[model samples]
Structure formats: C-alpha cells, structure tokens
Target: MQRKIYITIILFLGIVMNAQSGKVGIKTANPKETLDVNGVTYTNSLYLRNPGEPTMTGGSFLATSENALQLYDPNLESSGLFNYLKLSLTGISGAGVTDYDTKIDADKFLIVVHNYSFKMNDGTTNVALDYGDNGTNDNRQGSPDVVAFKSKGTWHIRARFTDSKLIALTSANPGRTYNNFTIDLYLMAYKRLITKQNINDITSDLGGTNGSSKTVNRPSGF
Candidate 1:
C-alpha cells in the first residue's frame, strides 16, 4: 500500500512540475528566414512568392520597401508603390522570464537594419523611426518601436536596431520564478502629411501661404 502511495505522489509531483513550466514567445522581423531561439536557429520551409501572395502555415506576409518592412495578414492589400520589400521574422522559441502574471520578458537581443534607397517625386519626403526595447522592461517607455517615412516622391528607407540591454520583466506566469531572458521588439511608424498649400507656402517668397476664406454652415434642421 505504501509503495502505491509513493508511486502516486511521484506521478503527481511530475505532473505538477510540468504544469508549472511554460515557454517563451519569439517574434522575428522576417518569417522566411530561420530564427534563432535561445541560441537555436530554425528556418521556415514555406516562402512567400510575392508581396500579396498567401502565407503558408507558420508563416506571415512581410512588406519590404526601401523605407520599411512590415508584417501583415496575407489577406491584406499590398502596396505596389513600395520600393523594397521583405518578410516578417517573428515567433516564440524558448522559455522567457515572467513578470507579474501578465507579460514575459525577452533576453538580450539586437536589431539589424537593412540599407535601402529610392528616388523621390515632387520633392516630397517621407521618414520612418525604428526603435524599441531590448527585451528590457525599462527600455519600453516612450521609445519608438518602428517608424515609416512617406513623401511625394520615392525615397530610400533603412531598417535597423539601435540599442540593447537588460531590464525587469514586463509580464510573467503565476507563482513561478524566472531568470531566463528573451528578446522582444516593438515596431511603430509616424507619418507627416504634406499638403499642396504647405508646399506652396514653403516655396513662397513670404514663407507663408495665402490664407483661405473661412465659411461656416448652419444646421439645416434648426
């Protein structure tokens, strides 16, 4: 009887231990390229045929232009005007450090920027900002994860990572201890729209555009 009881306890403990363990999520900038997770790298067999082609299982559509590379659902529309394009290499690979039951912190990581350039039309310019935390909690605040530049004409845009570091966990599992690390990246872009009036103003001798007449319309039902 004691032997059976011991066996059951051992099995229960094993189950509990397994249940408490979790995995770290991995996200990549390019899905077609093999990603290195916890020092282990694996390539995706599926490839994207074109910008708007359907994505295979475990793969996603990545839009790359001279200015930027963006990941999107395969069902989304493609931008034919982009100068360059690439795939999104994002995923989860190994165990990551946990925070307060909400987030998992990535380990040390680096961002790689691709050099690209393009011609512009109408002398208009576009710009992108590429910035984010290096899996460190403190680095996330007020940082631009990614940026996109679009102007009237074609322009070259490059993507890259500028910094890295170690910080606190942003999220974690319940009742678990973690010292593990994973790399997480956030991408964002800001666009400044230029209008014909502004262009004229900038080129005007007075450095300002002529003011347009203002008119107000009253409610019709009143």
Candidate 2:
C-alpha cells in the first residue's frame, strides 16, 4: 500500500510538471495548445465569449462582434433574401402592358432587370438585337424599351415605343406586335416593410476621411 501511494504521488507530480510548461495534453505526450486533447470530447453545451464576459443561459445565444460575421444577422428583417425569375412578355404591342403575379409583397421587395431576349414569330428569323439603337433608326426596330414596376403584389411590365407610329410605317409587321419577348428579373425580397420610392429617394454620401467609421441604426430591412 505504501508503494501504491508513492506511485500515485509521482503520477500527479508528472501531470503538474507537464502543465507548468504552459500546455497540457490529454491522451497525448506532446501538446501544441493550452489544453490539447488527442481524444474525443463531450460536453452538454459550448459557448464562445469575450474575456471577462458573463455566462448566458435560458435560451440565450452567442453572437460575435466580428464585422465579417455581423454583416448578416438573422434576427433582423430578411433583407438579404434573393430570388431569380424569368418572365415571358408575350405580345408586346404599342402601349400594351403585361401583368404577372410575383407572389412577393410589392411593398417589401426590389426588382432589377438583369437580361432580356427577343424572338419573332413572323417570317423574320435570326435577327440580331441592336442594343444601342433606341428606335431612332427606321430600318431596325432596335432593342425593346420597357418599364417594369410592382403593384398590389403583381408585376406590371409595359412596352415603350420611341415612336410606334414611325416604327409601324417601316416595320415588316405594321401591327407593332412583338412576340416572344422575355426578361430575367433579380428580386431581393425583405420580410419587413420597405417601399420602392423610399429606396429610390435615398442618396447617402459615404465620402469622408479615410478609415473613419460611424455607428448608425440598422436599415429598415436589415
């Protein structure tokens, strides 16, 4: 029994001496960190917090102050939510409009026209679209000029003609019917309320001294 007690004291001294070197390893001979464990670890809860921070409990969560991680906070409105959609604008005629059900709230979303493609059902085939011409050339119909807006949870798209009457006189299809017109829209929807007019009216001046920072409230959406 005395020999066994001497062995336990020596083992405890060995562990203390190892820890005094600034790093202690569990199930490992050489440790690279303060508390390196070579084997698996189990714990009921894990938390990360700043030094001297108080422990949190009762449904509380850990959050970081890092800017890269703080850029997106799920607690705020989902302003970063993005959606892509393809819209078929069929039978675009002079002063004609097409309506589509977006299913996204009109007051809480923003839309941007990403790209467009046009097709002709008439005899004309393989006609390249001229993006620079805005209906000024009589020989060519030019790219379709249109305006898109959301109203009452629906998207309203309308065709704008520089001079529909003039194009009708020179176009092969005098009826001014543009068949198979399509557009790709990029939608950014937010769960909170935001208006198109409010975003449009914003003109923030971010110019200032270098490395200067300011604290401000989160935007309406985020």
Candidate 3:
C-alpha cells in the first residue's frame, strides 16, 4: 500500500512539471491562454505600467490611448475636459437669435461654455471683444450681450444690444453684424451614456411625500 501511494505522488508531480511549458487553467479544464482564470479574480493591487515608465500615481486609474479596456484616451489632445470651437455668424442683421449645430449628440454628450472671445469686422475695420468686455462703446459699438446655451440637440448663441451712439461704418445697422462676426469659444464636455429627462419642477418635503407636476399648452387643447 505504501509503494502504491509513492507511485501516485510521483506521477502527479511529473504531470505538473510537464504542464509548466503549456497553458495553466484555474477553475477550468481547458485554458485558452497561458494563465486562464475562468472565475472571478481578486487582487490587492494592480499595475499596468509602460516600458521605461515610472510607477504610476496611487489610488488613480491610468491608461494609454491603446489600452485593452478603453475607458478614455488620455493621450488625445481633446480627450479630457476642455475643448475649443470657432464659429462665424454670417448674414445676421439686428439683435436676434442664431443657432449652430455643434455636431455633438445631445444625448451622449453634455457641453458647457466656459469662456469666449469675439472679433467683429466691417470691411477694413476690425474690433476684438472679450467675454466680459461689456463696457460702454468707444468708437465702435462695444460688444453685445451674448447668451450662449445648448438646446434642441444643438448650441445657440443669442446676441442682444442696447442702443448706443450711432457710429458711421459700412451699412446702416445697429449693434453688430453677421457679415464678419467671428466667435472663439472655450468649451468643456462630459461623456454620459444614460437616458435624458427634463424636470420641469423639483419639490422636496423632508420625510414626507414627493410629487411632480408639469403641463404644456397647445392650440388644440385636450
């Protein structure tokens, strides 16, 4: 009986040694990779470092542009939070609203305008205005009060101006014109993959009931 037990141990050790050059599977009979683990794997620490790169910062996830599980590409110029946009307003007269398609889907992405600059030109003259450049008009009709927002699956910038001293220029138009109006926008965007809903009202009664009421009026009332 002792001899049979010794023979069984020797055979098991030999089999393990032979499998060292082949695939090893855990909780599985057939392993597709070198170290295939079919069940959940738990590790105290995980590191994915590039060649010749120093140790990554702790408590933060890091990856390159071509990582296996592509969450975000840190190497991209416009990958993170901030991006830029330049728009030209053409053929717009007087104070009103103008809409531009940002080419960004309203559902999957959320964008916010941080800062902006504008350049207005009439034939040969040009005036540059910053966002907070709402001072009184000098020789030119200063900057218009521009309200930028995103709605209806696009971006809209509405410009309104107060009546100022009339200055001689190209055409007889008050405020700014769309012929040579250009705007530089600094924008921030967030990627979100979820259902979008509009909340008309928000009510909170601590430790009590909560409800919502919303209504829309139309020509054909029902």
Candidate 4:
C-alpha cells in the first residue's frame, strides 16, 4: 500500500461570518460584532429602499429641488386639518369675527409679524416696532405684548407670538379700527387631524342617545 500526503487551506479576506446571528464583519480578524469596520470607510452616496414597506417611499443621499422627500400616513385624510403659517397682515377691527375658522385645537395657530417697517396710514412712517424698540410699539404705556399703538395712526407691527385664528387678529379692543394692509395667514391645519365622523361621534358620546333626534338631522321635507 502507498501513502499520499495532501495540503488544503481555506482563507477569508479579513471577513468573518456568524451563521447563528447572520452577521458579517470587515477588516477584523476575530469579529465578535455584526459589521465591524475598523478604520474610516468613505462612501460617495447612500440610498434606502423598502420593497414591501408601508407608507414610506424611500430615502436618498443626493438632494433634489422639487418634491424630493415625501412622508405619508394612511390614517390622514384629505379633509384633515391643514394650515399655512405665513399670515397676511390686515387691519384687525378688534377681536371681531373677521372671516375664518377660529376653533383650531384651542387656537393652536399663532400670529406674528416681521419687525420690518411699514408705510402706516399716518403721514409719519416709523421704523418697524420690534421687541427692543419698546415705548413705541404700543399705547398701553409700555405693555410688552401690545401690538398696536394709536387707534387710527400708522403702526408698523413686528413679530408676535403664535395665537388666534388665521383671519382674526385679536386686539386688546376687538372694536378698534385697523386700516391699510390686507393680511393673509399661513394655515396650519394639521395640528389635529379631525374628521366629520369624529365630530358626530363626539356629540353622541357627550349627550345624544346617538340614535335619537338629537344626533340625527331633520330634512327640509320633515
């Protein structure tokens, strides 16, 4: 009988595999971690994709201009609350019921104006009234939060804390006269997502028997 000797060897390129945990390591001789990258690893770009994920479209490293990023939740409805925060400044005649929906999450939307000077209706145009530019912002005798000064004079309104409805600019006196400058507001309609059905349910849960005349609407024919 003749005896033969053979030499065989297996090698890995600085990589380790854990079959139990399904983990891989790089540049590590004895890899005890999933992905063990020793030194600085550079990459030009990166991408994220979910083949069967729900609601999440994807992600990318390179930025785009138009509609590049999107997030969607199936629960949100088209009629749900939406808002535009960039509000237009108009003369608020006191806290009158201007022309808009005021009941938003107990007035979640707030109003503020730029401190930039404006052409007041009055002949003398004053510099924009800012926080530091006190004594001039209001006629309330140095009241901090007051926005208006004279009732009919030119008052350049600066920034204000977010409060009140989009259209209704609440003043100390709701009946005061506001002149010049048509204001528009940036709507923030999504502070709370409410549906028509939710309103009905609330009414019924509170008082109505739900199936009685209280909850039901009577038609014109009736």
Candidate 5:
C-alpha cells in the first residue's frame, strides 16, 4: 500500500507539471488554441455563466464611452437603434452612377437612417434657381433613384433621378454636368449574434409596441 501510494503521487505530479506547458485538446493530438475541441458543440445555460463573459440577459446595452452611437444619440428624435454600417456616397454626377451594394452575414437585420446631403458645385450658373424639373414629365429626370432594399443578404442603391429629370437634363445638357451631389446615409444592421431573449427584452424594455419595423420619414436631401 505504501508503494502504491508513492506511485500515485508520482503520476499526479507528472501530469500536473506536463499540463502546465502542454496545450489541452479534446480528440486531438495537437491543439492550435489554448483549449481546442473537435467536431460538434453543445452548451447549456450554466455554460454562459463563465467569469468575464457578458451577461446573457439583455436589456438596453450601454456602449463604451467612445462609441459613435453616443455621439449621434442626441440627434435622433426617438432614442433607440445602434450603428451597424457607416456608408458614404460622394462626388456623384452626370447620371449612370454604379449601384452600391453591401451584403452582411446570415441572420442579420439592416436598418437605414439617411442623414445629410451636400453639393460640391452648383452645376452651371445664373438662372439655375428653378424647380420645374421635378419628375413631372419624365423629361428632365437627372437625379438618382430612391434607395432600394432587397434580401439576398444585401442592401442596394442605384443613382438615378426622377424620370422627368432624366429626359429633360439629358436632352438639354446631354452631359448632365449640372447635377453633382453627395449624400451620407446611416445603416443600422443588427448583429446575428444577438440572443433572441435579448431581442425580446428590447421589445419589453423600450415599451415599443409598434413591433420591429418602425416607420422613418426620409428627408428629401437623400
């Protein structure tokens, strides 16, 4: 019994010392990470309670102080939503602007908030102060088309003005040099990784009875 106990202590010490330097692997001879596993994965509620992990229970997550959402928070009429994408459309002119498309990963949701628009040039001189070319006749539609949303996991935008402006501007100037513009739009794409329970928590916490899709009145500049 004394010899057996001595051998067990020797074995335990050997294992403890060896494990200090060796990476641990499950079903693997060599592990690339500190703790590596092979094949399928399974978890339970208790698994999420690991130390230093973010709370599994979600409600009004406050971002870090340097987060951009905090900066824009004051500008929004209704307080909610987080930034997912910051997209810019700049220095566009003469029609035929290539479409813009961004595809996010699976199970993600995208929301847009159009903010501001600006012009680099006034597009030709003097009497340009006219509003007669507003898609009425499809004669002078020189502006870009409205933003388009499609679900191949992408958000798409095409630059084309009202049909009337297309006709009038193309016919009159041909080059359409008088319509250079730029715009800033915000994309609020929620991460797919957000827990469903947290999502429900948002609905309950915010008192937002309107459901997921809230109507946004787009400014004319965009």
Candidate 6:
C-alpha cells in the first residue's frame, strides 16, 4: 500500500509540472475589436493622464502633469491592454498662437513624455501629430502608426503640450489666450513577439498566396 501511494503522488507531481511548463501561442488583433480571454469578453476605451489642472485659458495650460500618469477605465475590467501599448494624440480645439506644432519632445514636457528609447521589454512607442497647412487647404495628418517594442515588465506612457504662443503682438499679455485649443489621445496595448510574428506571417502569406483566401492561426495569448 505504501508503494502504491508513493507512485500515485509522483504521477500527480509530474502532471502539475507539465501543466506549469505549458506554452501559450501569442496573438495580435486590431484594438477596436473585442478581446476574448479565458472564456470572458472585454471591451472598453483606455485613457492615461497625469494629475493636474486642465489646460489654462491665457497662459500655459497644464494638460497633464508628471506624477499624474494613470489609466482610466469606465467599465473597470480586471485585465487590460497593459503589455502591448500604442499612443496617439488629436487636437480637438485651439486658438491664439500663430504657429503650432506637436511632437514627442523629451526635455520640456518631462512629466508627459512617452518612452522612445529602444530597450528590452519597453515594447514599442509611436507618435503622430496633425498640423494645418500655413496657406494651402490641405491639412497634414500625422499617423506614426503602431510601433511595437518588447517589454519584460510594465511601462508608463504620458504626453503634454508646450511652446504655446500667440500670432498678434500684445503688450497686455493675456492670461491664457490659447483657451480654445484642445487635444485628445488614444492608447492601445499589444503583445510584442506575437505582433512581430503576425507581421512576418502576413508579409509571407501575402507574397506566397498573393492575397488568396487563407486562414492563419491566431496567437493564443495576447
């Protein structure tokens, strides 16, 4: 009886070890689509911001602060797109300053800057800006599309506006003339390895199959 019990315990231990060592296939998908994980479906918008007063009226407005980097979820789900991340910004409204440009500047916007440096587990960082033509009707739309990077752990993303100005000369010095300007951002998460593999497979499939009707296996865990 003792021998039999020992054998049973060994068999159970082996099964547990194998289960722990199992591998999960990584996958990628358009963030707009619903993500189903472990028999549950999750759908929501992700927004990140630092704690600070809203943009000012005449003087420099503080859209986001350095220590205010935080994720806001209306639905409040358990799991989120924390690993694979994307950053996008859109100007909603603006006024005053003659020339306006937005880029991923590091020095001035210290608190609201996103990670652009290449490093392991940093995942990928992308940026886009929209600027209206000085004279022509054609407005420039900047879409630095999703850039992916690998991250071994969690990362922070943030952004803020700087170099606020006015076109006309004024001695009075308005309090916050750029009160009309407004900006919005969109954030997304994606697994790195799976994302890379997906792109490679897509290019290969396109070249080999010539856009033929084919179904590729989706990444298992993303």
Off by over 4 Å in 6: 1-135, 144-152, 158-181, 185-222
lDDT of 5 by residue, 138-180 (tens): 3232344555465566667554444322222234444334445
Model 6 lDDT tens row, 35-87 = 21223223365442422333233232223123332233324533332332234
lDDT of each: 0.31, 0.48, 0.48, 0.33, 0.45, 0.31
How many residue pairs clash in model 4?
24
| Model 1 agreement with the true structure over 101-179: per-residue lDDT tens digits | 1111112111122422211122222212112433323423332223333333322222232442222233332122222
Give candidate 1's whole-model lDDT: 0.31
Model 4: per-residue Cα lDDT at residue 131: 28
- List ranges where model 2 is wrong by over 4 Å: 1-80, 94-103, 121-137, 140-144, 165-197, 201-222
Clashes of each: 43, 0, 0, 24, 19, 26
Instruction: Residues 1-222, candidate 4: write the lDDT tens digits.
Output: 122222111124334234345555555555555555556565566454532234322332222223332233324433422344444444532222233433333323222332322233332332132223232334222222324221222222332322221111233322223354333333343433222221222233436455555554543332
Q: Which of the predicted structures, 2 or 6, would earn the higher lDDT when compared with the native? A: 2
**Model 4 / residue 209 / CA error / Å:** 56
lDDT of 3 by residue, 1-222 (tens): 999999788755654654585966665556556665666666666664342233343333333343232334456524553355545454333332345566676665667666654444343334432222333335444345555566887656655444422222444333443445445556666554333345344444444434345343432311
* Candidate 5 wrongly placed segments (more than 4 Å): 1-81, 96-98, 121-145, 164-180, 193-222
